[model samples]
Target chain A: MVTEFTPWQSLGGGVLIGLAAVLLMALHGRILGATGILGGLMRFNDPADWRLRAALLAGMASGPLVLLGLTGQVPAVDIPISNLAIVLGGVIVGVGVSYGGGCTSGHGICGNARFSRRSMVATASFMVTAFATVYVTRHLIGG
Target chain B: MRLLTAFAIGLVFGVGIAISGMMNPAKVLNFFDLAGTWDPSLAFVMGGGLLVAIPGYRMVLGGPYPTFEPRFQLPDTRVIDRRLVLGSGVFGIGWGISGFCPGGALPALGTGKPEVFLFVTALIGGLLLARGIQSRGLRTKAST
Candidate 1:
C-alpha cells in the first residue's frame, strides 16, 4: 500500500548531509547535530555561537526555496498522524533528545561515523525503541 | 565568514533532506512500519551519509584544529550511562509516532505549516523543561 522507496534520492540526500557534516567539522570543528544547534541557540550565552546557530537555522528554513528552484515546485509534505500525536511526539522528542545528549544527526550520523561507543549504544537504544513503538502503534493498537 | 559557511552547509543539509524524501513524515514513518509498508529509504540515507562521513571525519580530525575554528569542540563523555539509553528510547517513541526527528523537522519549518510550528514549539518547550529538570537534579545532588 505504501511503496515509496527512492533509493537514489535518499542516497543523494544523505551524501549531501554527510558533506554538510564533514564541512562543518572541517571548517569549524563542530558537530552538525540539528537539535544541538537549536538547543544551543535557545540557551545561547555567547554572541559568536548564537550568530552561527542562527545562520544555520536560517539556512535550513530556506529549504523550500531551494527545492522550488531545483524542481520548479515544492513537494507536498504528508503528516499521517493527528495533530495531538504531533504535539505529544514533539514534546517527548524534545525531552528525549535533551536527556540523550543527541538525536539522529548527532548520535546516529556523527557519533556512529566516529565509532564512538556511547553513540553506538545510544543509536541502538533509540532504533530498537522506535521499531517497538511502531509495532505497537501500527500492529497492536492500530494507531 | 564562519557564519556564512555554517549557513551554506545547513542549506546543503536541508537540500539533501528534501531530495532524500526524509522531509516527508509519512515516508519516514513507513520506515518503522515493518509489518506494514516498510520503506527502507531511511537506511539508504544513513548509509549514504556514513559513506562520506566516516572518511571525512578521519581527514578532518587528523588535523590539529579546524581551518576556521581554533579548536575542535567535541563531546568528551564516553560513558554510556542510563540517561543516554532511556532518553534515546523515549525519543524513539516520539519519532515513531510523528516520523519527525529533529534534523528532519527543522528543515520542514520552511513549509510554513502550522503543524510544523506546533511540533517545533512543543519540542522547544520539552527541551527547556528537560533542561530545567536536569539542572535541578544536579543541584539536588550537589546539596546532598
Candidate 2:
C-alpha cells in the first residue's frame, strides 16, 4: 500500500534525530551512528564504553515501547521482504557499514551535515546504488 | 547519570524513527523505487535530521570538551579511498533489497519483527567476519 505524505511528522522526526545527534556529541565526544554504537558495544571496550553503549542500545530497544504507550500503534510494516533477503541484506550491511565506517545515519545524515567530503561522496554513491537496486528489483526482477 | 541520558536519547531516537516511518520497509523501499512509485519522505527525514545536527555540531565544537567525556572522539580520517566507495556500494544494494539500514533496523526489532532479528544476527556475523579478515591481514602485514 502506498503511504501518504507526512511532511510534518517526518520533519519533526528528523529534528529529533538532529537533537539526538547533538545531545550525544555534547554529552560525550562521539558521533551518533547506530551501526558504530552497536559495533563498539559488541567489540571489546572499557567498562565505561560498555555501560554507555549498552544503555544506548537498551534505550533504543525501549523506544518503540514508549511510542506504543503514547500512541498505541506504530506505522505498520507491510513489505514483502523474504527471510533470505533479510539475511543477505543484514550481512551486506554489516560488512559494508563496518568497512565503510558508517551507514545512512553516519554518512548520509551526520557526516554530510558536517560538510565532510568523504561523507558527501559516500552518500551520493549509496543513494544512486539504492535507487538502481530498487528499480532493478521492483521493475525488472518483478519482486 | 550518563547512562540515564543515553537511555533517554535512545528512546527519543526510537520514537523519531517510528514517527518518521523509517521502520516501515515498504516506505523505505519506495524511496529507492525511482522507476516505479517513488517516495521522498525519507528525504524530508534526512533534511530534518541535518537541520539541527549541522548547527548542533557547531555549538558542540566550540566547547572545550564534551560534557561527560574527557575529549571528543570524532573520526579524523579524510581519505576517500577504495574502502569507503566499495563498502558503500555494497551497503546501498543491501539497503535497497531489504529496506533497512543499521540505524533503521536496530530499533525495528522492538516492534516484534522476527525477520529483523534474523537480519541483526547476520549483520553481527558479517561484522565479526570482517574483523576476522582485517586481523589476519594485520597479522600478515606485521610478520612481513
Candidate 3:
C-alpha cells in the first residue's frame, strides 16, 4: 500500500479530459463516451456515423503512444492479478458499458457535468462497488 | 471539419487519461482502495473534468445545435432502473478486479501487450453478448 500523491498531473489531465468532452460535444454534437463511440464502430450500427467514429477512435488510440513516446515516460501499472482475472474483469466492464450505457468518464465525468440523475446513480453504484471490491481484495484479504 | 474535430477531441481525451495516471491500473486501483492505500487523484480528475464540462455543457446547450451536426447526439436515457444499477455494479466488480475501464484500456492499446489483448477480447465478447440480448428483446417487442 505505497501511496504516491500526484495531484497536479491528475488535475491537469482531468481538465484536459473535460476540455476534450467539451470540444467534442460542441463541435460534433456527441458525448465523448468512449464505449458508445467505440461500440458503435464495433457493431457498425450506422454506416453514416462510421467515419467520425473511426477518426475519433484512431486519434484516441494513438494519443498515449505519441505522448509516452515523446516523453519516454512509461508509467507503472502494478496490478497484482492473474491474466485470467484481467480477462474476466474486461468482460464485466464490457458488458457493463454496453448495458449501463457509459463508463466512468461517460457517467462519472460527462454525465455528472450535465446534471443527469441516471449518471449520478450509475457513478455512485460503480464507485461504491469498486471501493468495496478493492477493500475486500486488498485490505481484508491482503492482496 | 467534423472528422478532424472528432480526431482532435479523441487525442486530447487519450492524452488526458494518460497524463492523469488513470491509464495505470495500479493508480486506478489505488483510487478504489478505500480501506487501504487510497489515492485521491481520482477525485481531482473528476473535479477538474467536471469544472470544465459543466460550463462547457451550458455553452453547448445554448448554441444553435452542434457545429457540424443538426442535433446533439446525447444520451436520452432517463431511467435509473435495475438494469443500469446491476450493470454498473457488475462493471464495478470488474473494474475493481483489474482497474481498466473502457476509457483506460482503449488508450493502452499502443502497449500491444498480450494481457491487454486478452482483456479486450473478453470485453468485446461481453459487449456482443449484451447487444445480442438487447436486439433479441427489441425483435421480440417488434414481433408482438
- Chain A TM-scores for all candidates read 0.95, 0.93, 0.90
Model 2 misplacement above 4 A: none
Model 3 misplacement above 4 A: A1-3, A141-143, B138-144
Query: Candidate 1 on A37-91: residue-level lDDT in tens?
Result: 9899896579899999999988887877789888897745688889999999999
In angstroms, the error of model 3 at A45 is 4.3
To one decimal place, how large is model 3's interface RMSD in Å?
A: 1.4
Quantify all predictions' global Cα lDDT against the true fold: 0.89, 0.84, 0.84
In terms of DockQ, which candidate is stronger, 1 or 3? 1
Please tell me which predicted candidate would have the highest TM-score against the true structure: 1
Question: Under CAPRI classification, how is model 2 graded?
Answer: medium
Candidate 3 C-alpha lDDT tens digits along B1-144: 877888888889888888887877888888887667778887888888999999999988788888888889877779889999989888898899888888877777756666766777888888998889999999999999
Q: Could you tell me the TM-score of chain B in model 3?
A: 0.89
Could you give the C-alpha RMSD of every candidate to the true structure, in order shown?
1.1, 1.3, 1.8
Q: Which of candidates 1 and 2 reaches a greater DockQ? A: 1
Clashing pairs in 3: none
Tens-place lDDT digits, model 2, residues B1-144: 999999888877877887887878888888787766777888899999999999999889888999898998878999999999988888898888888888887778788878878888988888887888889999999999
For candidate 2, give the lDDT: 0.84
